[model samples]
Target: MQWGCMDFRLLTFGDLRLVDGKGSIVPFPEKGLLSICFLLTSSSTQKARAELAEFLWGDIPLDKALANLRQTLSRVKNRQDELGIELLLIDQATVSVNVRAFTNDLALLTAVSQTNPHTALEELLQLGRWDFLARTEVIGGSGRMWLRTQRDRIKTQMLTTLRDAISAMSEGADATVIKEAALRLFEAHPEDETVYQILGETYAGEPQLESARHIFESRRKYRWGELPVDPDPQTLSVARRLFERQRSVAPQLREQATPQLEIVPPVPRGPPKLVLLPPVNLASSHQTAVFLSSALLEDITVGLCVLKTVTMVAHYTAEKIALHLDRDAMLERYAINYVLDTRLNFDGSIYWLFAQLIYAGNDEVIWAERFSMEAQNLPRQHREIAQRIVASVASYIERNEFSRDYFERNPEAYRQYLLGQRHLKRLDLPDIRRARKAFQTALKENPYFSPALSGVARTYHLEWLVTAQGDARLLKLAEEEAGKAIATGQDIVGGYHQFGVAKLYQGAFDESIEAFELAETISPHYADVIADYADTLMHASKPGEALEKVERAIKLNPLSPDLYFWTAASANYSLQRYEDASAYIERMADPSQAARLAAASAAMAGDTRKAKALVRKVKETYPDFKIDTWLSIVPLREQWQKDQYREGLRRAGFD
Candidate 1:
C-alpha cells in the first residue's frame, strides 16, 4: 500500500470508522480508535501493546484489560505469515503503528495546524468534530486535566493564529477568508463585548449600535450577579446612565415594587457541600440544549435544597459550571466526593435521561441507566435524578444518623414543594402567589412539609427583607408559617436551615447555628448551604468561622453562585482588596450594576432615580418582583445572618 492511503475518505477521532481506499467501512470501537489515534500520532516505538491495553481499559482488571487488547489486535483481521508480527511489532517493549498503513485526522489536523492554519481550520470545521470522548471525561484525574490543557491550548492557538491571519489581511485579500474567520469568531463568542463592538463599528454604516448595545446588555446582564463593580466602563456607563435618568422621575410613578425583604437568620455555617456537573450532551439526542440543561440543574438543585443532607449549589452556581463545560474539573475544584452527571436523549415522545455517577476518589462510575419518560415527565425526571442521587448517597446517610435527621417529612408534600420549585422562575406576581399557594398546599397536604413550610417561611422572609416589598403583615405570616415548617422539619437538615433562618429573623441566634449545622451535615455538596451558613455565622459576629465554612464551600464547589464569589469579594471589600473586590464583582452582573448604582448614588439617595431606572429594567426582565419574596419565605437557617445581609444591602444603599 502507498503511504497515507487512509486519507482518501473520512477520518474520525471518536468511535473508530475506517473506510478503505475502496470506500468500505470498518467499525472500530473505542479501543480501536485510541489505538489508531495513538499509532498515527506516535513515533514508531511509542505505542507499546501493553501500554495500549492500560490506556484503553485503565479501569478494568489487568488481565481483562490485556485480554481485550489482544482481542482488538486480532480483529485487525490481517493475516500475515512472514510479516504477521510486523503489524504487531514490539521493539524494546514499545508497540509501533504499522506506518505501513492508516492515515488519521487527529494526526493530520495536528500536523496541518502547525504549518497551515487555514487548511487546518477548514478541515477541522468541515470535519465538524468535538474533542475526543471517553478519554476526556474518563481518564484518571491529572492525566485527564493534562489532555484538556493540551486540547485547549491547541484550540486557543488555532483561533489566535486564525484571527491574526484574518486581521493581517491585505486590502485585496479574499473576502471569503475574512468572512469565514469573522463568522466563526462571532459564532463561537457571541457574548464577547469587544468582538461585537468591533463588528458593530466595522459595519457602522449598517446602524449596528442598537444591535451591539443589545448584545452587550444581554451579556452584561447574563453574568451571575456577583460583580465587584459594574461591567466595562462602556457597558457600565450605558446601563448606569439609562438607570440614572429613569430613577430621576420615580417617586409618584411607582407602580412597580422591589422584592420584599424580611430578615431571616444570618447565612448559616457548616452547611453540607454539594456540586452538580454539566450533563453530557448526547451525540444523537434531540433534546434542546438550553432548556433541559438549565432546567435539570435548577430543578435538581432546588429539590435537593429541601432536604437537610443536601447543601445544594445554587442555580447560578451550576450555571457557571455548565458554561465552562468542564465536569471533571468541577468535581475536583469543588472537592465533590460524587457527581450527578445527567445526559438526555430524546426519541419520539420519550425523553430518556441517563444520569450517571462518578465517585471522585476512585473515578468509578456507579452505573449508567436511562430514566425514560415523556416530555411531560420533566418534573418526574427531576425527581428521578434527585431520588437516585439521594439513593446513591444513602449509605453515607445511614452511617451518619446526624445526616438522617434531615428527611422525615412527607414525600408528597415534598413533591408539592418541588412543584413550587419549578414555578419560582416564572417571576410573575400571580405565579409567585401560585407558588406560595403550592407551598401552602404542601403544608396543608402534609402539614409537616418542611420544604414547603421552610419555603413559606422564606417567602415571608423576603417580604420583610426587601424594602420595596416589605409588608409587616406579610412578614408576620411568613414567620408563622416558617415556624410551623421548622417544627415539622425539626429532624432534617433543611428543617433546621429553614428554622434557623426564621429564628435569626426573630433574632434567635444560638438556635440558628444548631439548625445550620444540621443542614450542613446532610447535603455537603450544596455550596449555597455553606454560603448561607457562613452568612449566618457572620451575622452572629463570627466572621472567622463563617470565613472557614465559605472556604470549604468554595472548595466543594468552585463554580459558585457569583453571589458566593460576591460574598468573598465583599469580604475582600471589607478587608480592603479594592482591586480584587472590583475584579471579582466585575465578573458579576447584579452586583456590578449595584456597585455602579452605588457609585452613581454616592456621586449624588433619596435619589429614587437610580432605583426607578434599575427597577424599570428589573421589571422588564422580571415582571413579577413580588415572587422574589419567595426566596425569603422560608425563615433563614440563621436569622442574624439574614439581618447582616439585609444590613449589608442597606449599607450599600439598596432599598
Candidate 2:
C-alpha cells in the first residue's frame, strides 16, 4: 500500500502497518513487525532484550530465542535505514522504540482523549470498528497472550471513553453526536437494557417519532416476539411520552443539564416469583424413592428462596398446585414467572432425577439437567444434587430478571449492590475502595440485605489482600460484617463464605474450615465460594483436599477467574508438583498477580533461567519487595509450608 506521508506513520489500533516517508509500505518480517508493535505499545516504550525475546520466541531455548531476536532486530534496522528513519534504539541489554520519530494512530487517539474527548470519541468509534492487532500474526504462546491482554485493555478504554463523552455532553449537544455515540455503545454491549433505553430516549428527543418507535420495537422484538401489525397504543404512548419529557427538560435546563440529568424510567418491580412443583414418578418407583426425590426438590427450593433474590412459592402451595389437573391455571393463579419441574425414574439399580426450569409466560425451558445415583447412595448424595439444581435455577432466574429489568425488594439497594459487584470484579485498589462505598450505600438502604452485607465484607477482605498490609483491623471489620450477614440471614451462602475468607486471613484455620463447610452445606455449587474454600484448605496445609476442591470449582465454573488458578497453583506447589503449579499459573489471565509463586514454581521445577527472569519482573514491578517481609505476611498455617516457599524463592534468586 502507498501512503502520502513525509514521516514514518504506523497504525496499531486496527492493524499493524508501517508506512515510510516515500509513501510506500515497508516490507518487514512478521517477527520484526510484532517486535516493533510490542515496543511501541509497552508502558515504557522499552524492554529488556531477555524479556522481549521471551515474549517473541518463548517456546524455544533462551539462547536460540535471543539469537532469533537479534536477527529480527537486524531485519528491522535494515527497513529503518531504507526508510531513512531511526525507529529503534538498541543497546547491549535493552531495546527501546524511538516513538518521537514515528506517528502512530494509537498515540494520537490517547493524546486526543486527554485534550479533546469529543474528537477522541470519534477516533475511538472508528478504532472500535476493528479488533486490535487485527492483521498481526503472533506465533509464540506468550506473544498471543500479550495480544489478548492488549485487545481487552483497548476495548475497555473505548467503552470508558465513549461513556465519559456521552456523560459530558450537555442538553444542547447535537442530536446526531448523541445518537451516534449511543448507537455505538449499544452495538458494543447489546445485552445492556439501559443502552436500549438511552438509544430510544435520544431518538425521541430528536423528534424522530418513527426511529424512536423502531428502537423500542427492536428491543421488544429481541426480548419477546414480533409486535402486532398495528403497534399497541401503550407502546406508542411510551414513545410520545418520552418525546414530551425530553422537550420539557431541554427548554428548562439546556445550559446546565448533562446526559445524566436525562429522565430515566422508574426502577422496575420486585423479583420474579418462582414455583417448584413436586417431582412426577415417571417410573412407578417405590413410595420411598418418590419421597427421596420430593425431599431433594424441597431442599433445592429452600436454598433458592434463601438467596432472597427470587420469590419462591410456599412448599405446601406448590405441592397442592402440582396435583391440580390444569397446571396452567394453577401457575396463572399464583402469578408465577418461573416453574421448576422434575421427573423421577428408576432403572432397576439407579434412580434418575431430571429437572428443568421453565419460563411460565412462554412455557419455554430455560435450563435442564439430569442427575443419577445408585439407590443405596441416594440419601448420601441428595444435598449435592439439590445444590446443583438450586445454583442453576438461581443463575437463570437472575439473568432473566436482569434482561427484563426486574429487581429484588428495595430496587435501589439491589442496584447499588450490583454496582459494587462490578467495581469489585475489576480487582484494582481504587476500584475496590469504590466498591466498598457502593456496598456501604446499599447497606444504608437495607441494613439486613445479605448480599450487600457480604459485599461489604468482601471489599474489606479484598482490600487487605491487595494491599498486602496484613492489617488485623481489616480482617476484623470483614469478620464483623460477615457475622452481621449471617445473623440477619442465616441460610444465605455469601455470609458464611465471606466469614470463612476473613477467618482464613486471620490465621484461624479451624474456624475458617467450619465456616466454609457450612457455606458448602448451604450452596455446594457456588463456584467462587468453593474456590475460596480451596485456598483456605491450601493455607491450612491440606494440599490434596485443596486441589480436589479447586478442580471441582473449575468444573462448576469453566471460565473461572485468575484467583481460582492461583489457588490451584499454590496447592500444587505445596504438594511438590512444581510443573503442575507452573501450568496452572500459565492459565491465569494475568500471571504477574502471582509472580512470586510463579517464580518459585519455576525454580522448584529446575528452570533457573525462567525463574530468574520472573524474579527480575517482580523486582521491576515492586522495587522494595523483600522475601522475608512478604512471607511473614502470608498466612501459611504450617512452618514447613513457609520454609518450602522460602527455599523456592531463594533458589529463584529472590533476596
**On residues 1-655, what C-alpha lDDT tens digit does candidate 1 reach at each position?**
4324344343553334556567576444444445555555434436665657655664445578778877766655343222222334444445665555555456555665666555555655554443443233333211222243334444465456555554554544343443444345444455444443333322222211344346446655564133222344343444444344345545544334221111112234443445565554655344344345555566466556544344555666565665575756765665556656666666765666666766767778876667653433444555556656666653122222222323334544545565665566554556666778778887776765566676776665554554445355765566456445544443344445565565566555555665566566555555666777876765565656766777777664555555565555544433333455455555565564345323323223244454355445545655664322632742344455445444433433344
- List lDDT for all candidates, in order: 0.51, 0.70
Off by over 4 Å in 2: 1-409
Q: Write the per-residue lDDT of candidate 2 for residues 1-655, one digit (tens) a residue.
A: 3233346777674557776676467665667667778877765688899879977875466799899989988888886677666677778899987777777667755675675556776666554443567767775434554565566556566556655666676766664655676676665544444455556555554433455556666756663342112333334455667656555664546455443324445355665677767775554536555655665455445445443335656454566677789989878865788887878777777777777888899989877877764443433344444444445444322121112111234655655665676576478899999989988997887787776788899999999988888889999889878867765565577778898999899997866877787776555455677889999999999999999999987754544578889999999999999999999999987999999999999999999999999999999989898889998888899999999999999999998
Q: Give TM per candidate.
A: 0.42, 0.42
* TM-score: model 2 vs. ground truth: 0.42
Q: Which stretches of candidate 1 lie over 4 Å from their true place?
A: 1-316, 323-337, 346-350, 359-364, 372-395, 399-415, 425-431, 467-470, 505-511, 521-525, 573-584, 593-655
